[model samples]
Target: MTAQTTPKPTESELEILQILWDKGSCTVREVHEVLEKNKDSGYTTTLKLMQIMHEKGLVARDTSSKTHIYRALVNQEKTQQHLVNKMIDNVFNGSAARLVMQALGNHTASKEEIDSIKKYLDELSNQ
Candidate 1:
């Protein structure tokens, strides 16, 4: 058993991942139905995408039954952290503060969200 490096999912792959994460394990057909509502794509395309994701170790496939069920193997938090780290390095020059500032400045965070962020910051300061 080897540790798998997280690969940045393509736009299509991310869509499928979002489905798997939200819906849990699903057959490719089940995924395709949800996908069709958002964008035009063939069932074969969805199947192929899941196949590639399996190969990349981003998703796990249960092949016991006639209809294979696919589930996300990559943790959503880990992937978000990985992407955030990449963005911080590339877009903000490794400054998480800059990213936070930009995010807060661009979006009007609710009072609850601001308070939550402040609480987190206070805890970090204590640490």
Candidate 2:
């Protein structure tokens, strides 16, 4: 197997990360409550997941206090950019134009959105 340059969390792990990122820090119960909005997740499941995440270095657990608060160690924006770049490299074969063309063809973007994208492209070209 290739060396893992990026940490790829499972969907469940990503869900937990999203909660910690949004709430700053939360106990397993708190995270489970927030996660319950979407699906039926167990309290223990959340606790176990967070524990595993801490071991993986994806999250930091504060055990000094009464309540074990979990916080994300990785910045969400940086992780998102890394994932996007990896996807672009693998799926789009490093052709941004291919991705853009596919996106434009797949979705019905508003005229304003199209204009905004065009404006950005124009600015980049100018630079």
Candidate 3:
């Protein structure tokens, strides 16, 4: 099986991947420090999670140093696209319109945001 066939990231892994994506490359201690700023995370927890992620091929480790820098193997945009496609297919019955309608109905949007969305739709329709 190829990387594409790999299972989707677990929730914990996703959190770690997000940090890697944003920070570019980090040591487990650095990641844990950043995560601690946001939530109650521990160093060992981050280190263990990064090791698991490396085994799963979700992250790459630079072993040039004893510090072992970690980086995300997947592109953020590609991951987001795959996740959105899965969500649209499974939760919206493969209908993009239904997905948008459900999301718009469930959340409150500012008038400016609505106008921007309408403009985007118009552009897509024109194309």
Candidate 4:
């Protein structure tokens, strides 16, 4: 699906998507192992989630092998942009500047990240 048409993933689905996005492709067990490190969940639960994600068009499944491999179908950047835009609108009252200010105030950004933000701001001003 197009970025604009990508379905909003549930929190559970988003977690699975993140794993797929990071690892490129993985079997359910591989994903579950990573997930288990953070939270308590069953292998069957991960399998079911991946199946649901496949049906939702959020991920692609390769059934060529006995061990099915799944990969994220949605673009990572697009998903992040979508979620961030929604948060900015709903939580920050559509004020991107306020969102930026709040985030910077609450979080400790690395020097490199601060420099990157400044560079992005400079580019935006140039445009």
Candidate 3 ranges beyond 4 A from true positions: 1-3, 110-112
Off by over 4 Å in 1: 1-4
- Looking at model 3, which ten-residue stretch has the lowest summed lDDT? 1-10
Clashing pairs in 4: none
lDDT by residue (tens digit), candidate 2, 4-121: 6446778899998998888898888899999999999889988999899888888988999899988998789987777778778999999888888999999999999999999999
Worst 10 residues of 1 by lDDT: 1-10
TM-score of each: 0.87, 0.79, 0.83, 0.93
The C-alpha RMSD of each candidate to the native structure, in angstroms, is: 1.9, 3.3, 2.2, 1.2
lDDT of 1 by residue, 32-119 (tens): 9999998999999999999999998889999999999999988888777877988999999999999999999999999999999999
Give residue 73's error in model 3 in angstroms.
0.7
CA shift of 20, model 2, Å: 1.9
Residue range 1-127, candidate 4, lDDT tens digits:
6766677899999999999999999999999999999999999999999999899899999999999999999999988999999999999999999999999999999999999999999999999
What is the descending lDDT order?
Answer: 4, 1, 3, 2
lDDT of 1 at 98: 100
**lDDT scores of the candidates, listed in order:** 0.91, 0.87, 0.88, 0.94
Ranking of models by TM-score: 4, 1, 3, 2
